[model samples]
Target: RAVLAAAGGVAAGGLTIGTAALLGGTGKGREPGGSPPEGEAAAAASEEAGTRAIADPVRRAGHLLRRAGFGGTPGDIAEFASLTPVEAADRLVDFEDMDNSGLEERIARANFNLTRLRGGDGRPGMASDMRAWWLTRMAYTARPLEERMTLIWHGLLTSELGKLGIPRTKFMLIQNELFRRMALPRYDDLLKAISRDPAMMVYLDTIQSSAAHPNENYARELMELFSMGVGNYTEQDVREAARAFTGWRLTAPPRVQLPEGASEAERRAAQDAAAEAYEPEFIIQPRLQDRGMKTFLGKTGPFGGDDIIDIIMSHDAPSRFIPVRLFREFVHANPGPETVAWLAEVWNGSGHDIREVVRAILKSAEFNSEAAYRAKIKSPVEFVVGAVRGLELETDFRATLRFWGPMGQTLFQPPNVAGWPGGPAWLASATLFARLNFLDAFLFPRGRPLRVEALLAREDAAGMVDEALRRLVDGVMSEGARAALVAHAESIRDPVERAATVAYLVLASPEYQLA
Candidate 1:
């Protein structure tokens, strides 16, 4: 429905992306005071000689947007292009002040039924609806970094709606909201909160723990995945940590009162309404808790869950592991030791402040280096969201939300606790087929004309391709790819069809698959 409306809007001349917007006009790469900002200057000084900062405003802006958020549109790129690299990075990092009411309003208008749960007879789609809601936010939100960081946290401090049980699927949404609220929080605080998070407790089996038979799932993942990588802690540490976390449980939500004359269907409806309003809070049962002194990580005491988290945060491994994870996510797949060391220093000095660590990463010499530019493959979510955002198209994408499963990255349904393999693992032949087909549906939905006549208004076939390239991918195409796209566009006579085909070809090309 939204796609049809957008097409109508395009026919009515509502769609526009002028040449000035494409080139960024006065917006291309401004250095405040005609020099690198203070942090960027220091980062520049740290680089090897001849390792220049990204000079092209467009490339630098694209890199920043791709890493810090999903991909950016031409207008988004133009806005960032005008600022110094440090200024741009800071703008995204310090995002709390940004007005997000527009995105909020869109979400309100969607009118998603958050309380809908799968029935006992094997009904489904509520989880998919939740996934669609988030995808919509990613595609259209004014503050992409916040959503980006929320995604990073979701991948790391992971949970699964499937294991959360059919009745409690909406808890995943609650956990998602928590990630957004504390997206850039201090590392220790985030860990502590996750230890007490209801969804996480359920997913990791923290709620099933007892003093006599402590559940080690949460403790093992806490060290191996969340804080430090494996081998940093001994088996004893896992056992002791599990003991400390015993008695962490989920509280029962209040049930709805059924009227005497209520029918069975009405009773079920009332129960679901109550369930929607009820979010289980994390609680501790003192009777089941381990109060005995236990030695964990060489520290002997009556340590509780908070104490274990504190010990993990105080260790040096989190400083290294977390920065390495951040580096992998943003900079490159394999970061040099020096880069990791620099980021670890920032992590330690900033007292695990996520905003400061992310700021240093965005301003780092390595992040701006050529090796990091388009170096990683886009995850399934990134690929879909980037196209929508870059094309500036409108659509009620909830209908297509199921594409994530076959494309290989289903939200709230990661294959395992380790999360998606990402990188090259996302480009398997079947997945590539899925990507191409999905682009076809997106560019020309059900034979409806593309809302891209504005893209066709450029000079000719080559010009239209160039304009589409600039709008979709910051004109970073190779000569061969550009020639191929132009040739493809020239073959199609109808300008609207030519423009849509060119846009589709460019997006389907392998060049656009890398971030």
Candidate 2:
């Protein structure tokens, strides 16, 4: 209860600070200050009208890590702090060069149960296993941006397990792997691929769509939520695109041939075995396709689903819309037209290559600006995964799976087609408690040993407090907050308890609440 009260106080204060940051209030990053730091003059000169470059290397690197990937550890921060802003951006954006075999090996050693896990009654455990698998990847992947971009695609190119039951849940992992593989591909190519994605076909009713009676769900979301924002396309466009996307289907499992007079249990086991063996692949039935010319987005053609995607990719709206969405994900909300226009130019110039656009955004003056730092709230996944990565926690990630739903952002289970509402919606009172409760479970697991030995190694109470703040919150806190944390720490007698208490307070602090 005391911990909850502290979290509440810090949360209220953090919200005020976050709200102020959003409403154009100045932060330490924005204080009328010294001439732009040594190497940042050119970058500062290029800043958009209202934005200023972050001059401090530590803060700049910290901001980049939180936005570009998940949050970084002290070693990660130290390594990035040594690089120039452009170098740092390159390191993260060009992450294909990084050796991630360690993470792969870790995953293999973990031996996650991606297949069926049966309890007493033979209920499938794939959903929980899938969630643990993804969270573990987010927490421990060597190429953080890979997982981050995978998450972006998952949320934007939304699908849900709630709709796809246990029998079909494996498709979600297939879709997830697709996102990771094509994490930084051309927008058109990704759209074309997702059009045939088995999970997407099922999620948006694309499998049910036919030439005679087309389902409009995928088409509407493709334009409104996925590619182009609302108002860029119309009902006519949706109908046409739906017709163009007809006949999409997944390969079916081989029929189970049960012996005559077999019990219901035997039949059920055989069916489950078949489902487990099935590997979904996209296929098109020519008879169900609408090969006739149809007008879409002001152009008439005998367009298939890929053709519809190609057209959307070529449209002016997606060039702007995709950049705006990426900017919101990596920088902040409410980006000005000039910034969007600049990003759209990168999008168009690179032939809708997402890697080029992400590179431009990461290296841009706007990304490192004071306006972008701590400008957005962390989603629950970010909150948990960032903590896990930042603290270097070691677990299979099974325990953390249950907390995601209560915190309102479950993997493969977005509430609807639009994905999580995000931003301020993540910090509702109930969800806030859920986050704190997650920290409680994470920091103090019942049977496991405490995970704050490094923190406890600090010489004294103040050192421990500062270490926690530094590791989790970029080492900067208001004097009052710092003093309060130190005082709280000093009062605790046991070294282990003292370290955990301080760590909890810092993690619960409003400063840590924001990315």
Candidate 3:
């Protein structure tokens, strides 16, 4: 009860800080001497408000780590803190230079059961494994930005296991690999590739589309959700794009030959095996394709899916739309028009290269500003993986797999075509409780010794509290919160228990809830 009371106090204090930060901004229209601001001075002040740099290196580095990827460890933050913002951004954004063989080896050693097991139910078990696989990568990947970009693409260009079914779950993994491989590709190229993705084809009913009956699901989502925001394109544009996207199909696996005396069970086994071994290839049937000239976004052509994607990429909306989304993901939710306009210019200049846009966002003063720090709430995945990465916890992520559903985020499953409604939605009361419960299960799993080696190096109560705060919350807690944590730590006699308790309190604090 005392622990819960102390934790609640820390949460209240942290909420106060977060709320202040969210509402706080530069005192625009006023001169520093308290005189009424002149026009140039006011403009300069607003500009400075948007582009001001974070002066503290530790906070800046911590902010970048939390936003760019999962939260970093103390060592990771310290290493990044030594570099300038531009240098730090470059290192993370240009992650192809990093050797991730160690992560690959770890994954190999973990040997995740990603495939269907013989004589066992497939989807349920494989789905759990898939979630664990991704959580492991997020926790341990050397190229954090690469995995982060993959996650962004997954949420944006979404396909779900609920629709794909047991036989086709492999397609989800294939799509995931595609996102990782082309994590920073040009926007047009990615659109083109995903347009032919098997999981997307099935999920959006693109495979069922044809010239005579062009399903508008993919076309509508592509413009309204993926590329451009709504009101930028018309229903007529959607119909036209759907017509162009017709005839999309995946190659079927060859029928398995059964023995002359084979039983029903044997036939079923052979079919399952063949389905498991099958690799889908995207193909377009010319007969089903609408070859007639159609108008799309004011351009008249015999447009196919690729042509439609190219035209969307060439449009003005995606220039603003894509960058705005990336900014929201990395910086904060509410971005000003001036900031959006500048990001759009960068997008246009770079020909919609994702790497360049991400690089600009990371290095931008706006991203490292006071407003950007702790301004956005962490998603469930971020909350879990951030804790694992921040605390340097070692696990295969199996035990915590069930917690994701309670937290309102399950891997390979998004609620709808628009993906997760992030930001404030992540902190709903139910999910908040789930998050706290998750800490309980994570910190003190059943029948396992508490793992606090990372925190145990600092033996004293104050030292332990500071260490938890430093790693979990970037060492930025109110004095009262710190004292409350220290008091809780001191009350516990066992060092391991003390370390675990402080860590739990810090993780439960509202400040750590925000990214």
Q: In terms of lDDT, which candidate is strongest?
A: 3
* RMSD for each of the candidates: 8.9, 4.4, 4.6
Candidate 1: clashing pairs of residues: none
Please report, in order, the local distance difference test score of every candidate based on alpha carbons: 0.78, 0.80, 0.83
Model 1 residue 330 CA deviation in Å: 0.6
Q: Any runs in candidate 2 off by more than 4 Å, and if so which?
A: 1-50, 117-124, 447-449
**Candidates by lDDT, descending order:** 3, 2, 1
Model 2, position 33: C-alpha lDDT score:
18
lDDT (tens digit, per residue) of candidate 3 on 125-192: 66677778888998999889999999999999999999888778788988999999999999899999
State the lDDT of candidate 1 residue by residue for 1-515, as single tens digits: 12222222112432221222122211123221122224565445434322556778887898889888988888889999999988998999998889888888887887655567743444335776688789888888878889999999999999988788766787888889999999899999999998898889989999889998999999999999999999899999999999999998988877789879999999878877777768687789999999999998888999999999998899989988998898889877677787778888999999999989888989887787655666677898888888777877776577676577888988988888998888767877678668776777777789765867548678599999888788766686545456666766677888888878877776765556777
Give the poorly placed runs of model 1, Cα more than 4 Å off.
1-50, 118-125, 255-271
Rate residue 60 of model 1 by lDDT.
84
Residue by residue across 1-515, what tens digits does model 2's lDDT show?
A: 45433433433443222343223322323342122222365345335323667877887888889898888888899999999988998898888888988888988887666777342344337788778878888887768889999999999999998898777877899899999999999988898899888889989999999998999999999999998898898888989999998988887778899889999998887877787789888899999988999999889989998888888887899988998999899988888889888988999899999999998889988788876777778898888887777777678788787898888999999999888999888878778778878877877788333658668779699999888877887776656567777877888888887877777777776677777
Off by over 4 Å in 3: 7-51, 117-124, 256-268, 447-449
Worst 10 residues of 3 by lDDT: 24-33
